[model samples]
Target: MSSIDFSEALDCLKKAQSVLISCHVRPDGDSLGSAAGMAQMLGSQGISAEIILPSELPDRYAFLFEQARPRVVTDDWRRAQLRGFDTVVIVDTSVRAQLEPQYDFLKSCNLPVLVIDHHLESENIGTVELLDPSASAVGLMVAELGEVWPAELSAGGAKALFTAIASDTGWFRFPNADSRTYCQAWRLLQAGVRPTEVYRSLYMRDSVGKIRLLGRALGSLELFCEGRLACMSLLKEDFRQSRAAQTETEGLINESLRIGSVIAAVMLTEDENDSIRVNFRSKRQINVARIAERFGGGGHELAAGAQLAGSIEQAKEKIVSAIREEFSRSGEPGGE
Candidate 1:
């Protein structure tokens, strides 16, 4: 990654009258909230800002959009606003590979571009990349970047910041989260964010499809290397029968670790087009993100993902082997 001083990047930001914000493909809460929160902060400072979601916003976040109502840049054809923006900010994505088709065009823009992320693998996705993998959420960091100071978060801004931190940490339950995360969440709450409201925004409903998806996921699960490793795969037909959206496959990999002794587990799912996506989760003894990063993806040490070609069965085998190797290298799967 190239050198970037946020204090120096601050100059480009404060001077720009028009700013456009974006996040990586298949954006999660931290990216979405950071992009929108940055826009809101800029607007508060009397700067004209636009926020765009490169992919369709995930359904779980619909409540946040309804509540904040930030303008999404995708629909507005205003050429001047589009062309006039002097700064472009991308958040949560650490590398170009995560941004997909949008990264090249955005990177080509002659204007100032900044990236704020908390992923360890960022090899510089922008002219200025402010990365703090230790951070709980990009939204928490963006508040600092915006000079909002946790002490000054508005109700809307507080909600955004809180949601970003809470959702990404899996409600303070993720292994990546530490005392700093709770402290930050407390700070956000003091700024007027409601914990219950934000929690509801994250996980309010359970559709019949999601239940079916869960059943299908549990039914297809298999163990390997004794109980040290496990794997599961969801096919297009399984999703269709379950009435589940492809997105519903979230958290399937964690089922492996639920057994309390398994070091790692992987869930492979084939989307409608036959493309396979894999989610990997590891507990106390393994590093799943290390494995995921090898396959061109990254997340927390205990959790990560990768995409593969051909079939879910192929993806399952590959992931299962990776986990088995990770465990075996640790001196023979120590227990049952």
Candidate 2:
């Protein structure tokens, strides 16, 4: 939770000759956008920077990189690539668990690490950490960095940054979208970012399989804690039946929050490896991130996620029990 100033982060980058950028696994718009934006910012400054992902880039975000190809690391030996860079910049997350495939390299590499994240929890994963819990998105932090670094945002960079801030704020519909978020959005718009195109690329281009996946996830919805909580799951069979890619599960959990009476929602998906991916979202005072942390996960107060090794049913039971316990501790009735 200790955040460093932008000047400090800029100073670290100022010393780097080459940079390797990265974000959390299962890259979302926020993480992808921030990483892309950071790469562009560094590139404009004449620093050779490239993005290295722990996983494949989601198809929905492929438009952001029409001009560049980010390296997707698939093996342990790829860790040697870390030695080639003077610095590593990890956007959107500071948790070691989220770093995944690169976690070992990051832990062992002597190269300076700069973490730009807004999550409430972090491991001592960075040599210079720019952790800001107040910023709505790490992209917002990057936008602010552009101003301080005095770097110009290319048309692509503006679009990438806009996607970062907008996605993390639920397109400004979430409670986290404060005035700062809107102001940054305005700045990107002034920089010639076309929101309509970005919106269409992100939302309107869903594959049919994604629609089927959404339907299946919604079909599994169950009410809990007297209708105050909603839980949903998508099994391995669900994915096979829907023919949906894992990335399509991105926003499924948020749909349950649309329920008029539900204050919190959970989405549990069975990964191919049989691990359960749990995503938590809330619309009120409950800190779902705290609940996630109990199970070795962390995120913002209202939104968070974790992965558990168990059957989907077992994962659901543990998650539901934890949410109910959190509700009880928060002094809300009907937690039983």
Candidate 3:
């Protein structure tokens, strides 16, 4: 709510001789970019910065790293790294719980735990918390910290931050995107990051397997709420049949919204263990987070998601039923 106190974030950065930045487990562009942007920005101040990613670098975002990759960590390494850093900054994630294994390490950090995130569900785990769900990500919040940023950050830092903002805000298509997102994006552009290149790298760079997986995902789609809702699922087998990784299905939930009469769209992916991961997207007048939260998940109103302990088909049915109930309240077919 208050202007993200870069003065506050800077104080922590300045105190640490060495800094470590971390993001959520399944690192999206915003999480990875926020981590890299912080590293580049702090490098300008002569501070050594590192990124600790929970998983391997996803394929599409590998290009963003030219010199270094996120230091992949085991659970033990994660704790040790969190302990050794002069300061640890958690980005893109609101609560430690969302980060699985690092949840406890972040809490026990001796120096300071600083949280710069945009998720509304944050658990406020840092000594210094600068979280605004209204903003697109911690990268956008970190971009505001350029006042204290070192000279080295002006270019690479901008690209990382811009990519984070662009991805999390659905390329600035979501309603949550505001003047702050666009203004910061324009600022990053001025810093010499090519918008077209970033776009090609982020969205346009999918593999052929990914394209086939998307088609299969769409083929499984069904409509509900008298066509106001659309939902689908892609199992692990679907990815194999399409010769795509699970990541290939990344944008399938978004495509569902393009249909006429669609008020809400959901895509459930069956992970290796058969537990379902849900992705939700919607137009106005529906709050996906409300539905996600009811099922022990969290995110924003317009776009939110959750992980469920059920079959993909069961998850899809539950989510679709939730959507039906949501629209019914509006005097629609399911209710109104």
Candidate 4:
């Protein structure tokens, strides 16, 4: 976590005339919500801020961009346009690898970077950082930053921040949603964010293809480590037959955790490039982030992801071996 004062980061932003904001590749709700919320907050101060995404925005999250539209980079030329901004604010991730192709551009731009994130094992790539791995979500931190500005959050900003905190903590159902998380959420509610409206927008609008894809994923569920570990895989063929977009795979891994005996879960997805995208989730006994780090990825203790080059079967073998080692090292049930 960064020791930089929250006020100091806000002061840096207060000095900027125009700012460019971004988040990690394959951004989830926390990343996108943080970016959107931050952009709205900066706009309230009369600072020009635009969001640039490394990948295409998922269809489900398109609502967030209506008020705070982002420019999704499609090529080298588009990426270059991110330069020349007065300041850069990176939210939800600080790792160079997570920043991808943007990291190269940022190196040459020589702009002062401010990182606001809540994740373990982050890299030092910020001029000022307000990181709190203990915090439930970066959106929470961003909301608190608004409090320091002593500005009442606009309805749009409040909704975006609400999405950030709710999504990261699984709509306040996950264990991470403590009193602080609820308090921040209540404040957003007071700011005119209707919980039912937001929930319908985020969860009740799944496509038919996504439902079929979920079925196939569950059909592939396999138990290992004496049923304490559950793993599922989805091949390109599965996506083809189901006609599901890749983004629909989000949250599918957590389905296995519903089983009483399962303490850990892994979801292996074959991307278009034939490389495997692995997502890990744990109920508490396992530190899935350490497992992801072994494969050159990092995230929270309970949830993490890694990309592996190889056929899905090959990726499965390597991941299973790693999970076995982690379970053994942790000396948990099914370790032997």
- Name the lDDT value of residue 79 in candidate 4: 42
Model 3 residue 272 CA deviation (Å) reads: 0.5
Model 2 over residues 158-189: C-alpha lDDT tens digits?
A: 99999998899988899989888888888889
lDDT of all the models against the reference? 0.72, 0.88, 0.80, 0.88
RMSD of each: 3.5, 2.1, 2.1, 2.0
lDDT of 2: 0.88
Models sorted by lDDT, best on top:
2, 4, 3, 1
- Model 4 residue runs over 4 Å out of place are 1-4, 78-84
Candidates 2 and 4, the one with greater lDDT: 2
Which candidate number maximizes lDDT?
A: 2
lDDT of 2 at 244: 94
Please give the distance, in angstroms, between residue 54's alpha carbon in candidate 1 and its true position after superposition: 1.4
| TM-scores for the candidates | 0.89, 0.95, 0.93, 0.95
Clash counts for all predictions = 0, 0, 3, 0
Instruction: Looking at model 1, report the run of 10 residues with the lowest lDDT sum.
Output: 69-78
